[model samples]
Target: MLDQLRQIADGLGQTLAPFCEVVVHDLLEPDQAILAIHNSLSGRQVGDPATELGMARIADPDFTQVLANYANQFADGRQAKSTSIGIKDASGRYIAALCLNLDLTLFRGLQSAMNQFMRMDTEGPRESLDPAGGADAIRARIDAFAGRHATTPRALRTDERRALLSELRAAGLLDVRRAMETIAAHLGVSRASVYSYAR
Candidate 1:
């Protein structure tokens, strides 16, 4: 049974290579329960002792069979997402477990990097990258419209929204490149909705 499980662990480890660690624990030998380990992220050896999870399963037959995407950390504090699956014998007693631990360091780093790359500057002086100053013009028109209506562009009423679109169209603001996108972004509506309103 353990041999078959070892084969399964190896196959899964290969498929999830370089990031995931697959461990097969022999619950019957809790003192040294780690029967096999592949991908080796945690630096755990084959004869390593069972974890608290293994002990928990041993103590309770009704313990959860599958625990997925639970937060875990290595000894060095690298973040991990893990899934643990329990195996039971013919009599329904938990016999072993298969655990997959995915190292999230690279993924977390990528997430942080992407966030930094996409973050917009909300402070300092306003700068318009548009050579036509179309964005500035749009903001000015919306501000004037809002100032006249005693409300913000996003807070404009349904009737007021139609009036505003009319005002924008008369000012040729709708003719600017990607004007619908800019207007919809400020007004918190879809481009299709903005085009519909303009019509």
Candidate 2:
């Protein structure tokens, strides 16, 4: 049974390799309970004494059979997430245990980087990505419309230009001063073409 447990531990360790350590403890041998250790993240050897939790399982059969995602750390103080499962014999005597400890440093680092990359600037660029109705807003809306088609404003087809102008006219964006020139310049068209499309 202990050998079978060791094989299972080795399989689990390989499956979660580089970041996780899988340890099997022979609860009956508290003095040297570690029957197998794989992935070796915790720097523990096979002959090491059982942990306090293992001792608890030995001292009390009623101890929790499974403790999952509990906070833990390595001797080097790196953070870890752990899950422990206790096995019992036919007579309900606690016999062995399997524990997996996953290092969280890499995950935490990735989380930190994502947070940094996604963080918006609170101190620079006085402009807003979503401004209220104005020339800036009109420009932002037009740019977005073009972006939806995976193209730039200046590259929109004549029919697309007419549709965009129609929308701007309905939205009263055309009422702004120099709106026609603005649209013409932004769309890389002549002012006469803007007037023609606005119809």
Candidate 3:
């Protein structure tokens, strides 16, 4: 049952690859941390944090906060909306759990469309990330960028912003172009708007 759930999540991740990333974790042993799968729009595989380059070691002090998040949210699947249907053996003793890390922003639109078309909420219960918080993060990043480069009205040009965004991606401040899109979406504007600001 656990394996089946993982496969299902993997398929969903692939299907939704165009707009977001999906991550799966096993909750039976929260610390075990199996990254069942992740798919990205930029065709980048989500690497295990432990093995990924430049990522702070999972064993670092900051790992405690990560663990706390896992225990508080990931383990329960309540805030995460990942679902924790028990994985049990034939005898019914609990074994493990399955989690789905869905991108709420993108999925919500598809879900609404499906609900409208089906005339029902086939979209199950959803726990979504704080889109507002994400937006604020982008604003903060923009402020930081402005501070770094002496931003002024003159700096806010389309081509300049695009170049800044491109530079940020190259510098690893942003991992993929989708990150730019996310920031743009959060700004309640087009990617072009964010690109202009980036200048």
| Cα-based lDDT for every prediction | 0.92, 0.90, 0.48
lDDT per residue (tens digit) for residues 1-199 in model 1 = 8889999999999999999999999999999999999999999989999999999999999999999999999989999999999999998899999999999999999999999999987896886677645977887898899989999989988788788889999999988888888888889988888887887
lDDT of 3 by residue, 1-199 (tens): 6677678767877786644344444434444435465553223232333122112222232221122112122232323222233344565444443333443554567889998888846487865465443444445665666567676423445655666566566656565436666666533467677656665
lDDT of 1: 0.92
**In candidate 1, which residue pairs get closer than 3 Å at backbone N, Cα or C atoms, i.e. clash?**
none
The residue-by-residue lDDT of candidate 2 on 27-139, one tens digit each, is: 98899999999989989998999999999999999999999999999999999999999999999999999999999999999999999999987898776443233667578
Which regions of candidate 2 deviate over 4 angstroms? 122-199
Which candidate leads in lDDT?
1
Question: Considering only N, C-alpha and C atoms within 3 Å, which residue pairs clash in candidate 2?
Answer: none
Ten-residue stretch with the least lDDT total in model 1: 127-136
Deviation from native of the Cα of residue 14 in model 3, angstroms: 1.2
What would the TM-score be for candidate 2 when compared with the true structure?
Answer: 0.61
Off by over 4 Å in 3: 1-5, 18-24, 27-29, 40-82, 106-199
Ranking by lDDT: 1, 2, 3
Q: Estimate the TM-score for candidate 3.
A: 0.28
Comparison by TM-score, 2 against 3, better one: 2
